[model samples]
Target: MQKKVNLASAGISAEESQLFRESITGAKPIAQDKIPPVVAPRKLKRRTDVLAKALDDNLFYFSDEFEGYIAEGVSLSWTKSGDDPHLTGRLRRGEFQPQVILDLHGMTTREAKAELAGLLAYCAKQHINCACVVHGKGLGILAKKVPNWLIQHPNVRAFHTAPKTWGKHGALLLLLSVED
Candidate 1:
């Protein structure tokens, strides 16, 4: 038990003590004197094995010999057969800003494929509809292969060579399908 002390003896003026008492006149003491312990939130584990398996089994096997050859300094554009006619035009015009950008610079074809798959997977998970893929103009290997890979992906609704400001000849803007 705690002993009650006199406010006057504690150097508190009578008026100040009266004001304090008045302020707490209707307040009741809290029944519990102790604070509840805080617990840390559980960490979420990433399923890298499953993602890797899916990437290897499902995303690989892109055709190395695509029928059409993309020439350097030229634009690339394509839209799914049933998609809106204006989709490619919209992409070309930069109407849909890229929510994510995957730069495939300095990566091998194998590495680029894995990264492209990962980017699409992330976009699908996040419900992002627009993305940009920058495949630099060095030797035009990725520049050509990127379009071929993108065209094969089921989620890619449309893609077009980005306009002057957005990596003109070296990048492609993608419109992805985010529907259920």
Candidate 2:
């Protein structure tokens, strides 16, 4: 035999039913003419200065902004010491194939700096020796800045302009120091 379930025990009372009926009756039908018109959402304007400031906060930017500027269309190469005799030749001749490549063509200055730092850290963790950074030969902002950043990094041994077959002046070949 099944027991009967009492709905009143579920907390619903006659007062509640009366209140619900009153609420339903109180709500009058809204006329079509009285209805509010739908409005389109306003578009937000982005401030470039705010974005630039935010990017600057996290990136490893040069303290002296004037130092990273290079002449347009000029090729650049740098070696820390004279001991690495073959590094320049190898970088120029495209002998040392890059195990990792980072392209900074379309990135903003702040984004490129962060990316370059991340790339070096990644290469160091993985023991990657040969790396390449393609900064393009545009106005030379990246070409100039990338070299400066590379030179400052302790893990970077040497960097040179890529050969004609490997992006030439538009790219750089980096020799990373493997940490024990």
Among the numbered candidates, top TM-score falls to: 1
Return the TM-score for candidate 1, rounded to 2 decimals.
Answer: 0.67
Off by over 4 Å in 1: 1-51, 57-61, 65-73
TM-score of each: 0.67, 0.62
lDDT tens digits by residue: candidate 2, 3-34: 86564996778788778788898688776787
lDDT of 1: 0.85
Top candidate (lDDT): 1
Residue 159, model 1: Cα distance from true site in angstroms: 0.3
* Per-residue lDDT of candidate 1, residues 1-180 (tens digit): 999989878999989988998999889887986888998998998899987788876575456665443544477888888989899898887799999998999999989988898898899889999999999899988987888888777888988998877798989899999977
